[model samples]
Target: MKATPADQQELLRLQSIDTRLQQLAHKLGALPQTAPLAELAQRETAVRGTRAEAIGALEDARSELTRLESDVAVVEARIARDTDRLQHTSSVKDVQALEAELASLAKRRSDLEDQELVVMERVEDAEVVVSSIDLQRAAIESEVAELEAERDAAAGGIGVEREQTERDREVVAAGVPAELLAFYEQRRARGAGVGAALLRQRTCGGCTMTLTGSDLEQVRRSAPDDVVQCPECDRILVRTDESGL
Candidate 1:
């Protein structure tokens, strides 16, 4: 294929633009905050699980405390009724029985009260555990929000750069011969992202292999407008004064 020397050089500019676009795409995908954000997501899931368990424990403790309070209330009511009867009793035998019953009720009430206190302490501890877990979850959420904001900002910048680079590519590519550009695109797809390279110092810039003997002679014999390819990498070889012929 024949392309003017000037058009051939434009291929290098196109390649540079394409390479920059590729770098920008890679940067977008590999933002520094991406991995940490994923890790924080996993951490948040685990933390939520822990928080759910803590909440369950707190609910259980509160339920137990309620039962204990109810038992204490019932015992106090019985004690009050027994004390009233003891105060109004006429017979000595009746008075003794009432006093004995009142004493039993008092002991029962004391035991229930003790148990209620213990359960109240457990409820308080459970609540503290839930509250601490809440704080931890909130911290994780905050960090996640910050990381997401950073990731979005980084991606937005890359997107803008990519759009500009693509526009530059379009303008550069429009100047290239359609047949030559198509061939270049095909080579780029089949091989590395680079489709053309400078032949500097007798070396194939695409593969970095020095041309010698017949290969060097062949390139020298070719017309200036004749497209030449590197024997090593099959990429279009763009020659200039630095080609070291």
Candidate 2:
């Protein structure tokens, strides 16, 4: 359909507004704080850190247990050697000295065994903690996967909408005069996506301010096909049949 230069300009302005609106929607959708994928990623990072700490603790516990066992073995060997010495020594003085050494070795062995038992218990507790953490990590991974899938689906939908909006913009852009389009773009850049609005009831929608009686009269007398800009907002004002005043 044939469109007047004024109509074409208005259409272009509408297209620009729609394009900006679509971009705003995309920007909002992709925000790190708002996007499900980003939140999932943060959670994944935390889970990984927790798992690392759990693994470290488990390893430390195992190492402590191993060390304690080795110490117990050394103490037991000392006890065995002292017992053999006590049995073989013939002189009364030598036997008495050997008995004293054996007694000390026995006490040391007992202490080492007790410590080893404590370490073994700690190892068991650590293993349980590791197992529980593994399960928690697995559950978090599953949730992350679900969130990624959801995010992908949502982004796909937004992509389709973006493509449609771009197509619509192209169609609308083809109708506008290049000079008018340039003017609107400049105004839009200055005013943050609000470069044009319908003038209604003697008010400029761009500024939300009513026009003076003289200005209203002047605007009314202006040619219908002419492009008019709001003096206050510098936004192109479209006069409409539905303007109440």
Task: Give per-model CA RMSD.
Answer: 8.4, 7.8
Residue 164 local lDDT, model 2 = 77
Q: TM-score for every candidate vs. truth?
A: 0.55, 0.52
Q: Which ten residues in a row have the lowest lDDT in candidate 2?
A: 1-10
> Mind sharing the TM-score for model 1?
0.55
> How big is the positional error of residue 43 in model 1, measured in Å on the Cα after superposition?
12
Question: Per-residue CA lDDT of candidate 1, range 58-114, in tens?
Answer: 899899889888888888888888888888889899899988888888888888888
Q: For each candidate, how many residue pairs have backbone atoms clashing (under 3 Å)? A: 0, 0
Cα lDDT computed for each candidate against the true fold: 0.90, 0.73
By TM-score, who's the top model here? Answer: 1
- Which candidate leads the pack in lDDT? 1
- What lDDT does model 1 reach? 0.90
Question: What's the TM for model 2?
Answer: 0.52
lDDT (Cα) of model 2: 0.73
